[model samples]
Target: MRKTGAVPVISGAWALPNAPQFSEGIAKAKELCRSAGGTFAVLNVEGEDEQSQSVLETAFRDARSDEWKEFLADCLKFEAEIAKEISIEKFTFAELEEEEQSLERLRRWFRDLKKRDALQLPAAEQAQKALNSCIDSLEAYAQSVYSAQNGGE
Candidate 1:
């Protein structure tokens, strides 16, 4: 992703009832951003369901309310602490397949989400920014891997 000269922001949500690996997962993702030269952030919010859109919208809006901005600032600090625990690891080929699968899952998720009668994510575009980063990162990573295999031709 760094090869493109475009900055990538790696972000994800740490929803309620978090698993034991949540911190590790976030830290690992942060490490990826670090190695690739990008920003790392997380949204620590409750509930990992469609009902959480309003909360995300408030946080992601262009002119976010002061309260939400402060909340996001706190989340950033928390994410920074989590990032401190990052343990460097190899990016396996299997993980690339997993990332592709996640992209398909994301597609299904958004399709189902739009089928709802009360879809209210006005800042949905803001969310798309993150997805675009993932796509760009995936392509860049694949390119780098291929180049390595080809002896850096």
Candidate 2:
């Protein structure tokens, strides 16, 4: 699952005697997050198998704390940019003169994002979920606009 604005906490169970690939996946995820200006954490839990999981856990948790805040800020800024794109696309003269039906969808997405920001999502998962919802709304609006332009149902 994709996450935003905070370190992703990945938790799952896998049989022991696992190869380095599993740890590599975690490392790759962290590397990807670093590239995106975010953070990642993989919590490998296999039913109290502490001896086996220590290596993976130690590597995952070694992330610098200072990066978390910077990552979160970058993520939020990204979300805001997405929201602005929706606004610009939805309310454009072409869109306004074309598909009026989609205006409500775009307005609702903007309002929901605003409301959620005010409410403070309280967790990374919740914030990510909210961002996904915003994307869904925006996509739906775009689809409606395109469908109207093309005379498609």
Candidate 3:
């Protein structure tokens, strides 16, 4: 979806040794931003969903609340951990396809969630995992596909 005047932000940590690898995986992320003529920042993303957003809103209801900023900082730490568990080059072609399929399932699940506001935290967490898995898979797949099509550099 083309965000209307929306900038691209790479939410997650990018300072550790393996951080560069994660960023490299999503190199197109910057390209995506450029194509859309938007800004890009490699920041951590925490509480991206409604529940977390609510917590933030409640914690600091002030117009200039910094709770959201703090949440993003926490998210960066979490992203670093996730990156340790799964690197950019880890997925295979088959796994990439599986991740893609899983993402589709998540999309359907999230859509269903629209009608139900009482969804459990676990379900929401699972959806997030699926989304991340799909991103990693696609990144690996793109790398492989590009290399193969170019006869491997």
* Residue pairs in collision within model 2: none
lDDT of 3 by residue, 1-153 (tens): 111111222352222112233444345666786689877555455677999756544432321123223333434444453354256544345654554564555455444432222223343454455456555645656577556556676
Instruction: Output the number of the lDDT-best candidate.
Output: 2
Model 2 misplaced regions, further than 4 Å: 1-22, 25-71, 90-127, 144-148, 151-153
Write the residue-wise lDDT of candidate 2 on 1-153 in tens digits.
212112233452222123343454456667987899886555444636876567544433333223333434544654564466466654443653433334344444434333323213334344455546545655666675666666666
The candidate, 1 or 2, that scores higher on lDDT is 2
By TM-score, how accurate is candidate 1? 0.37
Q: For model 3, what is the alpha-carbon lDDT of residue 39?
A: 72
Candidate 1 residue lDDT tens string, 58-97: 3333222332233334334433322332223224466556
Predictions in order: lDDT: 0.43, 0.44, 0.43
- Each candidate's number of clashing pairs is 0, 0, 0
Question: Highest TM-score, which number?
Answer: 1
lDDT of 1: 0.43
How much is 60 displaced in model 3, in angstroms?
A: 30
Q: List the residue pairs that clash in candidate 3.
A: none
Superposed by TM-score, candidate 1 places the C-alpha of residue 82 at a distance from the truth, in angstroms, of 17
**In angstroms, how far off is 87's CA in candidate 1?**
10
Per-model TM-score versus the true fold: 0.37, 0.29, 0.29
